[model samples]
Target chain A: MVLLEFSMSPLGKGESVSKYVSRSLDIIDKSGVDYRLNPMGTVLEGEWDEVMAVVKKCYMRMRKDCNRVSCSIKIDYRKGPKGRLSSKVSSVESQLKRKLKV
Target chain B: MVLLEFSMSPLGKGESVSKYVSRSLDIIDKSGVDYRLNPMGTVLEGEWDEVMAVVKKCYMRMRKDCNRVSCSIKIDYRKGPKGRLSSKVSSVESQLKRKLKV
Candidate 1:
């Protein structure tokens, strides 16, 4: 999974992030890709390349038309089935195995 | 001062925050408001109403045209000049005065 965030100077009027996000969604929809956008102003979940491509285009369009740009992206590995919950299993298992051996 | 952050679902393709930020700036500039948007995917500083109005409009547009929406808004009192410092200074002065009297 990848998480990306960006902030830039709102050129003349000094608007808000919500405005920018809405515009980008339109572009992504037109480009034909599967993704989910949350109301919290965050874009989450999608295939890597496709998502990146969409964001890049949107970022470019916004930047070209605005002044100053800043962005951040994070990608984390996702495990299958109980993906988030299982990471804890490893530590629990190790502790259990040690106790059993003792 | 007000600080606002919105993370939403990007409708069709999952995009990053940078894509959204660039777009807002343009609207702000055209609208004629004074504000600054930071690169950390945060919109900071601006006249109260203008910033809020722009964000609301932008947010609605994104939500109406997109799948989901989530946003966070924060308003803080900017201490003039910081005008006052919270730390060793005030206490130090008190201590010094006491010691001098002693």
Candidate 2:
């Protein structure tokens, strides 16, 4: 199983970055894995080297002090079955019968 | 402007997904948006809506035949600049005093 959506920021660092994206979401919530934080980016499952070692430790904690960093990664390697992050959006809202703003 | 990186896949489509991925790439190529495809995902640079529209089209394309689809997206919105796709990496390499594996 693999999901691994990612987003990193720090170019010039002036534009309200939510305090460096809350310090890389506090290092991906202490790297416990099985994450999902929407609004585009931050979804991790497991395996694939434990979600790429938690995205290389959130890009070495935003490359420490932020000189110019911008990371955007996306991976979706599937095998048999595992939680496809809310069952792949409930199978497209059960074929578009309703509910999708997730 | 924004940098969007996303990946989508059809579940149970039998492991090798290059065919589906190729289809999506074709769509992206035709959209005339600046993009870079990497091993992890495709990076697109454009206005937020422009990039997102491309992603939506890809999802719709995959949803046509695949019963279950999974999409992972990440966006980095920045102001006062553009062309972060290659520049971002070059900046890092410059600081590292060595080239990175792209």
Alpha-carbon TM-score of each model against the true structure: 0.34, 0.58
lDDT of 1 by residue, A54-100 (tens): 77887887887677655545433343432222222233334334211
Alpha carbon lDDT of each predicted model: 0.43, 0.72
Task: Compose the digit string of candidate 1's lDDT tens values, residues B1-102.
Answer: 443433233445464433443344444445554333321223434456756887776676666656765555544334333211122123333433321100
Best by TM-score: 2
Question: Candidate 2 regions off by >4 Å?
Answer: A1-102
* Shift of residue A52 alpha carbon in model 2, Å: 5.1
Off by over 4 Å in 1: A1-13, A79-102, B1-102
DockQ of each: 0.03, 0.04
lDDT of 2 by residue, A39-101 (tens): 335678888999899888888878888888988776677786768767665454454444433
How well docked is model 2, in DockQ terms?
A: 0.04
lDDT (Cα, tens digit) per residue for candidate 2, span B1-102? 798877788999987666787777778877999886544457788998899999999999999999999887766777867867766654544544454332
Q: lDDT of model 2 at residue B102?
A: 28
